[model samples]
Every structure is written in structure tokens, then in C-alpha cells.
Target: MTQQASLVALQERVAAVNDVLNATSVLTWDSRTMMPAGGAETRGHQIATLTRIARDLLLAPETERALEEAERAVLEFAEDSAERRMVQQTRHAVEHHKRVPASLIQERAALRTVAQAAWIEARSKSDFSIFSSFLAKTVELSRAYADCIGWNGHPYDAMVSIYELGETAASLKDLFKELRAGLLPILDDARSRPQPRSDFLFRDFPEEGQRAFGLSLAERLGYDFRRGRLDTTVHPFEVSFTRNDVRITTRYNRNYLPASVFGTAHETGHGLYEQGVDQAFTRTTLATDLVGLYAVGGTSFGAHESQSRLWENHIVRSRTFWQLHFPELQMHFPDQLGDVSAEEFYRAVTRVEPGFIRVEADELTYDLHIMLRVDIECALMDGSLAVNDLPEAWNAAIKRDLDLSVPNDAYGVLQDVHWSTGYIGSFPTYTIGNVMGAQLMETLRRQKPSLDASITAGEYSVLAEELRTKVWQHGRRFMRDELLERITGRRLDPAPYLAYLRSKYAA
Candidate 1:
């Protein structure tokens, strides 16, 4: 066959692999949100089988030759066009995939499944010991996976490359250091100031009303119900298989009014991004390879976090958002909100709460939660920490960082399910994403000062559209740094995030 024909065939093969991956993603989502407990073993086998298939297809020598040939054709014919971009992306993914052993791949998938089951059981019983052995094994597998990926700076950096390309531990450490310097003082100030009137936030709220408020908020933010659905999970997450089948799940706390509302808005931010990707790239090599390249479209885990945080904290917690919805809050909890003004409600939700649970943490204290997890993950991955000692270590970090004590393992080490799923070295992404979101929003505000008014008016189209144009639509066509610079004219600096915190809390 001619070289052009060979490249076309290679593209077809890559598309087929993505189709299998998308299908597998759907099953994985079900395993988390909808599947019954009895189906765990079968689900494990299914995920393992599919993972092996993807590994083998990407590892196949014929596909490797085809990819190389395709790259040559694109470079020779199109130079620096979209065709070459597709070839470069395909090559990059296969190179990393080739580095990871198939045995390790299958093992991680199987371990994650069983570990998830054990986590569900442990979390239900609030018993960390029940899941300790499984978690230990998961950590072991993650370390091995990290070594397979290889890194010059840190093993954690190698692991991070799986989710965020071209990011290093040193880079993140420097960013966090700058962040820490700015944040500690702001936190001190927040502590010194008169506390906001948050007593009203804990007032009795009906679950039905909470759900209605969340759905209405999501709709106002442009979440498409036809293409996506929201459900309740123990912990909230958004997982997508394709544009038409994105699912977001949130946990509802009846006692706390903002849990479901903000949680849904956060996950919806993720869902909308998934739904907004370049639709024309669907079912192709250009499609599956697109998401990780851009700085805005979760260009990094931090980029994704920015969207969630933007919606959850910056917008949802803002006085403007409440001004638009004080009536709704009154409708839901007339006894609670009738006497309260919008400013009071805003300050209440935005109160700086030092908490053990990361999900329940307020915006200011949230990074401390993330830093605590980052420390634990780093220790666990490097063999300095033990699974059995996790609770003590967790409490120690919480106390040192937030000056708070943990009352139980449920509220302490077992609060997050990330460890149960072989996702070591992933906790930093939450804080990093928060920083990225704040920085991006700063740039966005400069472009459109009326964002506050737009948010209050319940019109998020302009903001969402800007993100789609700058971040989401490009998919993974550019490197994270390249994309950030291209879109925002600045690198990914955590300083903006820190500045944002200082201005909000300290000022």
C-alpha cells in the first residue's frame, strides 16, 4: 500500500482502540456509581480484560511501525498542520504506553477493583483496617507502575505523567512553595477576623429541595440534561465515556445545605468540559488523544480542578450567585433563610472551616487538606509510611497543618476513596487545580469585568463559551504549558491563586 493509505489504516486502528477504551470507561463508571456489590468480581475481570486489550493493541509492533510511518507522512506532506499534530499526539501516547508493562497494567486494574470493593465495605463500617491490606497492595502496584514510567526528578513525577504530561515534582513543589508563603498569612488573618455568620448554613434543609436547587443551578450553568445525568455517590465525581454519555455523581448531606448544591455544580463543571470537547474529533485518534494536551481543558489535573473550584467556590459561594438565588434558598428553607440576607448567606458558605474531610473543607483551609494527603501519598509511595499507621499519620498531619484533631478513622484516613483505587500521588491535583482555576479566572475577569454581573444574572454562557474556545475545544493538541501560554499569555503560576486567596480573606 502507498504511504498515505498506510497512515489512513493506522488512523482507523487508533480509532478502534479509542472505541474500546470509551466502552470500558462506561463500565468503570457504572462500577463506581450504579453497579451492585455482587458484580464486583465480574467487573474486575471485565476491566482487566479490556485493559490488557488496550495495552496489547498499543504495544503491537505493527501499530508502532504504522504510527512511525504515519508521522513520517504527515511531517513530509503537511509539515505543521493538524495532520502532523494528530501524528505527534498518537506517537506520544504510544511511547508512554509502551513504557508500561502489560502485567503491571492488568495488575493495577484488578487491584483497583478489589480495593474499591474493600473500600466500600471499610467506609460503610468506618473501619480502615478492613481495607488496609488491599490499600497496601495498591500502593505497591502504583510504585511499580511509577518506576515503569521512569522519571529524572522524582518517582512521583513519573506517576504524574500518566495524568499530566510534562509536569514534574520540582515544578509543582516550587509552585506550592510560593503558594504556601502567601496562604499561611491569609489563613492567619482569616482566623483573626470576626467569623462570618455561618450558623444559618447548618439549618435544616430538605433533600428534595436541595436536589431541585442543584438541578436548577446546573441548568443555569449550561449542563445539558439530554447528554448527561446526575446521580448520587458516596463521594462526588464526574466520569465521561463520550460526549453523549457524561455522568456526574454527588453525595448529599441533609444537615449541610450547600453540600449537594456546590458538589453538583463542581461535578457539572467537569461534565460540561467533557461535553464541550471538539465534537468533530469523535471516534478518531484525534479525539482520544486530544484532552490531555491543552492547559485549559484539564491540560493538567490542576486545570480540571480550576473549573470545578471556579464553579464551586468562586461562583457558587459568591455574593452574586446568592443574590440571584436568595429567593430559591428562602423557598427551600424559609425558616432558615427568611430572616437571613444574601450577604449573610454568602459569608456563611464561604466561612473558613478547618476540617478533617477534604470534601467538606472550606476554600481557605482546603489546600491544607490537600497538602496533608500529598505528604501521606509521598511517604506511602516512597516506603516511609505504612497502611496500618495511616490513621495516626493522617491525624498527625491534620493537627500539624490545620491544628485540628480527628475523632475517628471515618472522618480521618478513610474519608476519601482515592487510596482504595490505586490512585496514589493524585491528591495534589485538587489543590493544584484550585490554583489554576483562580489564576485563569483572574485573566478571565480582566477580559470581562462584568463576569460577576453575568454570574448573578444566571448567565454563564459567556464564561463557558470563552473556556470552550480557549481551552476545551482544542482537546490535547498542545502541551499543558504551551496551551496555557497560548490561551492566557502566561505560564501556569500558582502566585495568582495565592494572590486571590490573600485578597479574598486577608483584605
Candidate 2:
């Protein structure tokens, strides 16, 4: 076959596979967002089937020959052309999937569907017993899959690499140590000070007003509702079927207003990143080779986390941000916030509180939640921590780390959807993003020192446009390391982030 013919075949294959994968996303999204309890079992099988189909298409025998032809053809293009990059990406994914069986992938997907439903029930009932068996099944499956793909010594390393490419447990330990060292002193000092009274935030906030206000704030964060929408979920998250169909979810709390305002902003950050990817790369890997779109997908989990943290922590929780939006928020909940000044409100919301739920954790105490998960998950994988013992260990870790007591299983082990979804080694990425987001914000502040001024003026598009130009438009065109360096002139460093935290809270 002619080289051009091979490239054409490769594109067609990629587009076809993406269609199935996107379909899987749609079904998964529907199940989470709209599916009835009666359909959960069937939906699990349907999602699994679609996942397997996508895997099969990508691994078909003809793909290897086509990849070889396309690689040659792509090299003939300029070194930096998108077509060349796509060829490199497709090849990397094909090779990686070769290492793991398609059946295993399908099984994991099917289990995750049922497991997620189980988690919802378990969390609702606040019963760890309901989810424990599913957790064990997932851990076993994940362990097997990790062994299959390869692990140097720690099986969790392989699982983590599935998310962060080259990240390992030890490396993450080092990163966390760096983050903790910087975060600790500030946490102590802030605790010693007179804490801000934020009782207004926990007053009665009606759901409809909260949703409407959250929707408006999401758009201001640069979420394009034309290409996206917001919904409710058991656990708040964002998903993208394609650049054109990015969707976000936030679980609102009537008593705690930040859950709507900041939670929606967090998901909106993810939505904006998805919507900002160049339309040219739609239904295709952003680049070929170093990591295919799949590996790129891995990079994205962390990258996307950075976006969410930036919006949620750095911006939404900032005093200046509230200076502009406080009145608007007051209009929505005057009974609750009418007397609260922006400064007092900011201090109230950002007050450091080590909590049971990771989703609602304060910025400083948030990583404490992740640290517990990483240790517990690693132990689970290594046979040191049994699934049945998870709640005990979890409560102990929370006590040890945050000095907070776990009252029950829901707040302890059944809180997150990650375990049920067959994901491990991914928790560290949130901490990584927390640090990276801080560093990136430092760079952003330098680039646009007037960022606070614009924000205080009820303007945020400038920040959104800046991120789009520097970080979002490329999609997976670059690896995470390369993308960070390109944007910030340095790879992931926690120093800038630490420095920001100390300066902000200390002052």
C-alpha cells in the first residue's frame, strides 16, 4: 500500500475507535447523570461492550502494518506537523495495548459500571459493607492488570504510571514530602490565629438559586455553555465526549454555599480545558508517539486537575475574586450573605479545616486526604491492607494525619468514586496538580500581574484566554512534562506553590 494510503487508513481507524470510546463515555455519563436504578445492571454490560469494541478496533491486526506505513508517511511531513504527531500517538497506544489483553480491559470496565452503582448505594446508606466486596474485586482486577502491564517492584507504580506516565510511588512520596514541608508551618500559624466566623456560608441556600448562581459563575470562569452544560452527580466531575460536548457536574449543599460556587467553578475549569482544545484535533490523538492519545489521556487527568484546583482554590477562594462576585452572590442569597463582607467571607471559606470528605477538604488539608488514600491503596495492592480492613485503616489515617475522627464508613471509605471505577495510583495526581497549579499561578501572576485587578473588576476572561493560549489549545500535542516546561519555563516544581501558600496565609 502507498504511504498516503496507509496514513488514510490510520486516520479512519483512529476516528472509528474514537467514536466507540466516545460512545462509551456517553453511556457512562448517562448512567451517572440520568439512568434509573432499574437500568444500572444492563448499562454496566453495555458500557463494557462498547469499551471492548473500541479496544478491539485499535488492536486489529491490520493496525500494525498501517502504523508502519503511516509512520513513514508522517516523517515525510514537517517535523512538527499535526499529522506527524497523530501518527506517533496512534503507534504508542497500539504498542501499549499490546502489552495488556483487551478482555482484561473489558472486564475492568464492566466491573466499574456495577461498582459505581454500588458505591452510590453504599454512600447513601453510609455502609462500607455494601461496597467492600466490590472494592476487593476491583483491587484484585487492578492488581492483575498492573502485573500484566509490568511493575518494577511496586504494582501500584505500574497503576500510577498508567496515569502519570513515569510517576512512581517513591517519586510521589518525595513530592508529597516537599508539599507537606511547605504547607505544615502555614497550617500551624493559621490555626493559632483568630479564625474567621463563616457561619453565613452554612445558612439555608435553596437548590434552584444555588444552581442558577453556580451556572452563571461557571460561564464567567470561561465554560462555554454552547459546548457544555452542568448537571448533578453523586460525586462532582466533568466529562468530555468531544471538544463540542464537555459537561460538568457539581453536588450542591444547601447549607454550605461554597459547594455550589466553588465546586461548580472546579468542574467548569475542567470543562473549559476540554472546550479549549483546538477543534482541529477533534476525534484524534493530539500527537503521536511519546504517548498516544491514551497516554495523553493519562497526562490530562493531572493537567485537568490543575485547571480545576486553580479555579477552585486559587481564584474562587481568593478575597479579590469575592470582592467582585460577593454582591452577585448576595443577591442570590441575601438572607445568608447580606451582612458578610468579601474579606470576612474569604477568610471564612478558606479557613483550614481537616475534614472527612476529601471533596470538601480545605486546600491545605486536602492533600492529607490524598496522602491517606495513597498509603491505603498501596497497602491494599501490596497485601498489607485488606479491603475489609480499609475503613479501620482509613479512620486511623485520618486521625493520624488530620487529627480528625471518622464517625462512620460513608465519610471514611465510601466517599470517592475512584476505587469503584477501577482507578488507583491516581490520587497523587490531585496533590501534584495542587502544587503545579500553584506554580502555574505564580507564572500567570508574573505574566499578568494585573490578574487580581481584572478579577476584582468582575472580569475573568483574561485569565481564561491566557490559559487557553498557553495551556489548553494544544490538547495532548505535548507530554505533561513538556507542556509544563513550555508554559512555565520549568517542569513541575512545588516551591512556587509552597511559597504562594506561605505568603498568602502568613500575610
- For residues 205-291, what per-residue lDDT tens digits would candidate 2 score against the true structure? 999899989988898887888988899988888888778888899988888887778879888888888888887777776611122
Count of clashes, each model: 4, 5
lDDT of 1 at 434: 87
Candidate 1 residue lDDT tens string, 1-507: 676786787777776677667767777788888899888888988888887786677668878888877866775656435567777777877877777777888878777777888888888898888899999888888888788777777677776666666666777677667777878888888888888787777878878888888888888888899988888887888876666677788877878887888889899888777778787655555557422211122345656676788878887777778888888868877887888998888788778878777887888888878877777777787789888898999888888998888888888888888887777766777886787688788888888898767776888898898888877776655666676687678777787788778777764
C-alpha lDDT of candidate 2 relative to the true structure: 0.81
How well does candidate 2 match the true structure, expressed as C-alpha RMSD? Answer: 2.1
Which candidate number maximizes lDDT?
A: 2
**lDDT: worst 10-residue window of model 2:** 287-296
Positional deviation of 262 in candidate 1, in angstroms? 1.1
